[model samples]
Target: MNLNLYIMLKSSTIALLILLSGLFISCKQSKGLTVSNMKKHHIESNIKGLGDDTILVYYVPLSKMGEDYEPIQDTIFSKNDRFAYDTPSNEPILLYLFSKKGEFTRKSGHPYRPDEKHIVALVKPTDQLNITGELKQYYLDYQVQGSAFNEQYTQVRKNYIEATSEAVSIELKLDALMAINGDTTEINDLFQKRNAVNSAGRNAHLEYIKNNPDKDLAAYYLTRQPWEIFGKYYNELSLNVRNGIFKNALESKIIKYKKYTQVQEAELKIKEGESAPDFELRSLSGNFSLNAVKTKYIVLDFWGSWCPPCTKGFPKMKAYYSKYKESIEFIGIDCNETEEKWRKAVLNYDLPWPQVINKLDIDDDVSVKYGIKAYPTKFIIDKDKKILAKFIGKDDSFYQKLDELMATK
Candidate 1:
């Protein structure tokens, strides 16, 4: 009778043990699901010496221009010299950080002078990046940690900077010389020396790309460097890196480079002594044709409303138009902008020249026809519709060329 009772108790104990085991397994699975569902990707930073300055974070793409040119910015105020950004993606991206005060200074100053108080960081989701440095050495003398790619980027950037420091110094001297109209021989010598340093830096970048084919930093440099120089490296990169966040951008660059090569081959058709490609576009005055404008000379200025350089160059264009209106025709072709923006820019700048709009999104037919790659590209055509000179950006040389051409009968 005692043995039977003991067996019954043992069976009951085994049943209870099995029930507890099932409950334990269920609870573990539930906890795992909860953890998996939680938000995981974030960018946290502790930037020292920034005080309470307003930090603006921007997602700057590789192309740096286009309809996507509008940066995705977050206005975060620094409290206790710290800020953070959270996103759902863990993919690496180019992030630019700037103080609101510095941004204002950048906008107000010469457009070409880069903001010295800004820093460019390679950040990704779930990265806890820490930047430590004084405000005076915002970009330089800073320490970054927490992401492998960012650390690699920082090292590469430091190497590049060190390699190009001599060239930068030479460039600064050259700028000063040019500002004061120094001797041509000295200026030319400085320019050549600077170019040689730049070449060395470029070679260093190539070697870096070769050594780190799998790194996203390589892909970034592939996009930033000239196609003729870095295109081969891009092909050598692993498929995984190539097809990452910058895949579409890299592909677009390849396409544009191919188009640019084609344009170079066909540039003879629009070079000096060759006839200009004729086209018609809608203007504020109404539909206008290039052939219809009869004058001793014509200035075809291809620009866009969103382009900062174009806006800066308009005042000079206006002055030139005022001086040469009697002897030459000035026409502005606005590209890749909405009608509203185009009109507003034209009116805001008081552009007296006949203005036309290119409705195409990218690589407008008119720009492609003339092999125009960048703005504000200007073409000087004679009465016989022959291309005399082509200018990429407005400068003293552009006006000098115009003067020389206008002087000709």
Candidate 2:
């Protein structure tokens, strides 16, 4: 049902918030429900003037692996103007609701319709939640009651939606302006307004956290806040609250936060002009080491086959590699990809330079050593193994820097 387009229009705000929240939650395999561990919850949904529509319940795990993994889903048919379902979990989990038949096109008659058929809310064990809304309004006009956490979540989410609406509007206007080569003055004003709105959202989030320190909703919100703010207030929660079922996810976040801190500290020591960290990883041909490469300069490209931006940027990188093959080496460090997809991407892109796979996991030892944060992160190193520059994503400036370095020799 064109889920991509559906999500783009309907869930842009939620997606943006999730992106800004950074990586904190990790989903773990659920333990099989047993008498000792089972906690069941009930959800009764009433959609006015609906008949014979299929309702879907999806359980989304809050783990790193679960982020890309398919959610556990169940289906129920609406009858007598209401639909109900039961969820069993060992702890609190996130759930998403969708109507199989609801789809609405935008006012502009965009070919793809937004999946206005759905809403998401938090649920805990033993909670009985009631949801009431019209099929037409869906998420925007829905009302949820009976679960305190869900109620608080709705409140916090409203503030976030309001705070980001102006920024999102400005961004859309900027996109239209750029499409038509509109006035630079208008573009700059939009940019300023966007940043101001984002700053206001962050401030509002911080205030919400301070006022609701003991609530699980606060812990959930904490996971989405920036690391700097998270570090400031994470320790303030009491032990009992921290150890609660809903808040247990924060434990893993704490561990990752510590690792992120260590990586940041390590990056300071290996900044530009410092010697690059040496590591050995297996390539398709043989074992390759950073110190053994025979070149005056090296470009370490950390990426994954699944990342669209990584693949999109490859043509430019390939062009650069062809131009600099004699004097510079380009090494593609494929991270968080299956072996088959990795090989396919290398062949698909016709990457001529040396390539290697992280082969272990997303956050491998080599990536940690270099403080790699995002995909398609490139580090340019000189003959002495000193880092010349580090850049993320593809741009003319990246090529310009490489050209300047190449011109030196």
Candidate 3:
């Protein structure tokens, strides 16, 4: 089974949707919702075989909420197999229940483990939820009482677990067998079986959305699906659901999907060895003319203060800058950040390089000229203004590629 299918079904679109404001911390006087000034909703869970571990709680971010799209994250230690959590949600939304042992990815903000012990509940602001079940048999025999949407999604979730269980089992078996060079014929047969099972599961989940468009829970199901799947049955959902809690998030997804389509269509807009796009970027000191820089090479770092991976990669970036400061011109292009933050970041990081700031959103018109789709993008250009390489993420690959170029000298 493809790992992405699980991501789609469970809807990890969360980590991706969080291209928004920084996360807000709602400090609690205690786990029992003691904050009088802040909006707090509570959830309690009592389970067998979970007393030894903690529960990680995460609520889905609402893109429609404007500045409040960052979800509240918390880790609660269970006392005697029972624990409670305080979440913030003014409307009905999805909340994830992850066992600490599940190793949920914080950066991605979702569970990558397909068979991880977890629960997905539809939480409403006014309702108090109680989850009672054996952790091991959660999908088969769990009870989420006191919320209609929670009850509705739990029903859908059970069958989904059943549909994908066999595939997950086979996937684990394949993992073990592949580790020791097990039977080739057996591996091939298992691969086919898993794919078949996953395809059926995917179809069934989609069919439920198609057949029962009136249920708001079905809209929740649609939320878990990727845009390719959601676009198919969006009109089928009830008008209330179409314009309800999911409205803002759904609209955001649609706009992003359209932009992604545009980026895909304009694949040739930026590439290595091509003439660098004609553009002007200003710095605090003076006009930072691109053509005027006559260094052996130019390393253009397109970054933003809001991006974690971008700023986190600066240590290694500075090391490279220090090594090649005399031979190469290093420039940092700050995008989608306020000028104040950009200037502060330059001073805070103590970066000895030219810095240019773009105080606009990622979708601002300026980004289109360079064909940038994501943050922390970089371009290495030769003295002749031809792009040598382009990198998207802040990773060792960019530095490794730089090393290959410098080795010739």
Candidate 4:
């Protein structure tokens, strides 16, 4: 019941690979991909032991992905261990699967981690992905038949799953040992061996991509690699592969890493204590301009709904806004997400402050202008747009500073 939260930007090699296998397939929305115009694809599964269960389906509109993203959700029910569904896709798109309200048992008292409770597919037009396996083996071991990408992903995932199997077994044993007050001396040695085994598996997956630069699987793996590795092979990819369905996703990752041929193009540099750089976003009222906002004091909250810490501070932030609404102006600059997600978060949080989205595609994105690297980054500016102070996280320090500054007000 205590499901681990899905991490959007974890840096683990296998985690990145899973994210790529399921979420990194993307395209540009401006290219005009509509449901009516798209081709439908088939997906069916027959896994033993999964009776009368539902597989939760999720996919990000490949066209409109951002650093902070959410997958659109749908579900398919399986009765008697079989199910099928159809989805529209003009090009390759990632689909993720999991059983709702289910945690497949492992050994003794530990269950398989929720993070590992997943099956992924690279769905394409006219494609039929058939998943067949024993549910107890976990989804990664599922036999996904239909495409070369599936073949490649399954092969690499085997190594990861094997390592995780051992890791999970060790974890359960460690828990049992700790519960009975058993000797924990061997536990350190076991952890060291676990790390060694996992490291070997991670290296194996990394090498698979490194050797197969021309494969589409390589594109996904390369996204997680550093520039030296990513840059070297990204160019080595075939022309079709380079400009394939993952073009936007790869390009977005490039921009995030701030490397490759886009260095000078992404050149927007500024620091605190300097005059805050001006930016603009269209609001329901009209264009909201940073320079045009006339206020004695402004609280610029740069955040995203996907970020737990960012959303966690909403109640306190709302309370502060209520107290200071008469004199201080508060602005919410939603970063690294689709506009739909931004709007949903606005309503969900009932953020009482004026909200606008940051232009992630543009060079002068507010996050870049102010050099913000963390979520819930705060900047307080005076009426003249002079940077008064800055805070990197959600803490009482920002409120403390605000109280100190507003003591006279």
TM-score for each prediction? 0.65, 0.72, 0.64, 0.64
Model 3 spans with C-alpha error above 4 angstroms: 1-46, 50-68, 73-90, 98-116, 126-130, 137-141, 145-148, 162-205, 230-239, 280-297, 304-328, 335-345, 362-368, 373-377, 382-384, 391-409
Looking at model 3, residue 10 earns an lDDT score of 15
Tell me which residue pairs clash in candidate 2: 26-62, 26-63, 26-64, 27-62, 27-63
Query: Which 10-residue window of candidate 4 scores lowest in summed lDDT?
Result: 28-37
lDDT of 3 by residue, 68-87 (tens): 34466665667767677766
Q: Which is better, 1 or 2, measured by TM-score?
A: 2
TM-score of 4: 0.64
Better of 2 and 3 by TM-score: 2
What are the per-residue Cα lDDT tens digits for candidate 4 across 1-409? 0111222242233343455334422322222111222543367777677777656666655554333455565666777776676766575567777654345343354334434457778887678777876665433457688999987787787657755656655655666665675676777677777677556555765687768767877777676565566666677777777687667667776665562224333224344456877888865456788888786688899888878878888999999999888778899998777889998889888888889888856465666667665677788888888888887776678899889888976
Give the lDDT of residue 106 in candidate 3: 27
Q: CA lDDT of each candidate?
A: 0.63, 0.65, 0.65, 0.67
C-alpha lDDT of candidate 3 relative to the true structure: 0.65
Give the per-residue lDDT of model 1 (tens digit) for 207-275. Answer: 878898887777766765765655567688889988876676677667656655665666656788889
